[model samples]
Target: MSEGSVRFDSDALQQRILALRGERVMVDSDLAELYGVEARVLNQAVKRNAERFPVDFSFVLTKEEKQEVITKCDHLQRLKFSPHLPRVFTEHGAIMVASVLNSPRAVEMSVFVVRAFVRLRQVLVEHPDLAERLDELEARVARHDNTLSTLVATIRQMATAPTAPSRQIGFVVDPLEKKE
Candidate 1:
């Protein structure tokens, strides 16, 4: 293939990287597409060289996670009915896949993939304030959540609690009373 055909946009690659299980990962299908191979082919290669990919490097999504990805990612809607769960590769795992594939396209695209991950990390480092602000916002939300939960619990208790009997408002006469 010509160099022009192998061109990749870092932004496009970064978009494919997702946060799953507290780590940045690219779906196997996305990597396969980038590397010019079928998803199953890539997975088969990974399986053949399983030692190269540790748990931290790659993992298959659970049923609930697969459903969640399908629900959230419009592109992954195709995977909704797929019998096999999709595998996700971390930054290191992507490099490992490139080595395993040993294809010119895979090697070329792996550089772009690494850059995309680095660019994402740079973004966070460049704007520490954004992360700090997010943390503050999360703390505020947590406090509000606690307050709301307490309020709801109090309301529920009040609703379920027994109430005391009320005294009669009008004057009462004793039974069998003699008139003066």
Candidate 2:
């Protein structure tokens, strides 16, 4: 790439990093692009240090979740990994990733990502109504889930129960006929 193009890409990437602030967490591919490395390389590093990440620290997106993101984020759609599913990093995972990568951009981007996560949390703290809505939604979902479980159990029992025997003439098979 030419110097001008490089600068343009750098500026665009910087703006992206900034936009990612507050509530939006970057996926592995996005971070890799900003850090100038292949996405798989970053994923391999994370895989190597699996013990450092619990589910909350890093988790793969379900197919439906990935599709929802694709629908929401325009820039995310331009990513080469549109078809490649990604794993998300929590604030702590982002910091830990920077430490392992040992690159200047990784370090710099990690600072931004961590700050963004913090900013998002701060915003949520300031919005009690949003929190309340989230709580109500969660409780509603839980109730529905419980009801669904009971319904499923009842359906299963009904299906498994033996039906009444039909009152019809039937032939009796010899014991030897049951054998192969």
> What are the lDDT scores of the predictions, listed in order?
0.90, 0.69
Candidate with the greatest lDDT versus the true structure: 1
Model 2 spans with C-alpha error above 4 angstroms = 1-24, 78-83, 133-180
The number of the candidate with the highest TM-score is: 1
Q: Candidate 1: TM-score?
A: 0.72
> All candidates' TM-scores?
0.72, 0.56
User: In angstroms, how far off is 155's CA in candidate 2?
Assistant: 30
Score candidate 2 by lDDT: 0.69
- Candidate 2: RMSD to truth: 10.6
Q: Per-residue error at 42 for model 1, in Å?
A: 0.2
List model 2 lDDT by residue over 38-141, tens digit each: 88999999999899877766777767767766666677785436666778776677788887788877777666666556766677689969968977997999
Please provide, for model 1 over 51-107, each residue's C-alpha lDDT reduced to its tens digit, 9 standing for 90 to 100.
999999999999988887888788888898789999999999999999999998899
Clashing pairs in 1: none
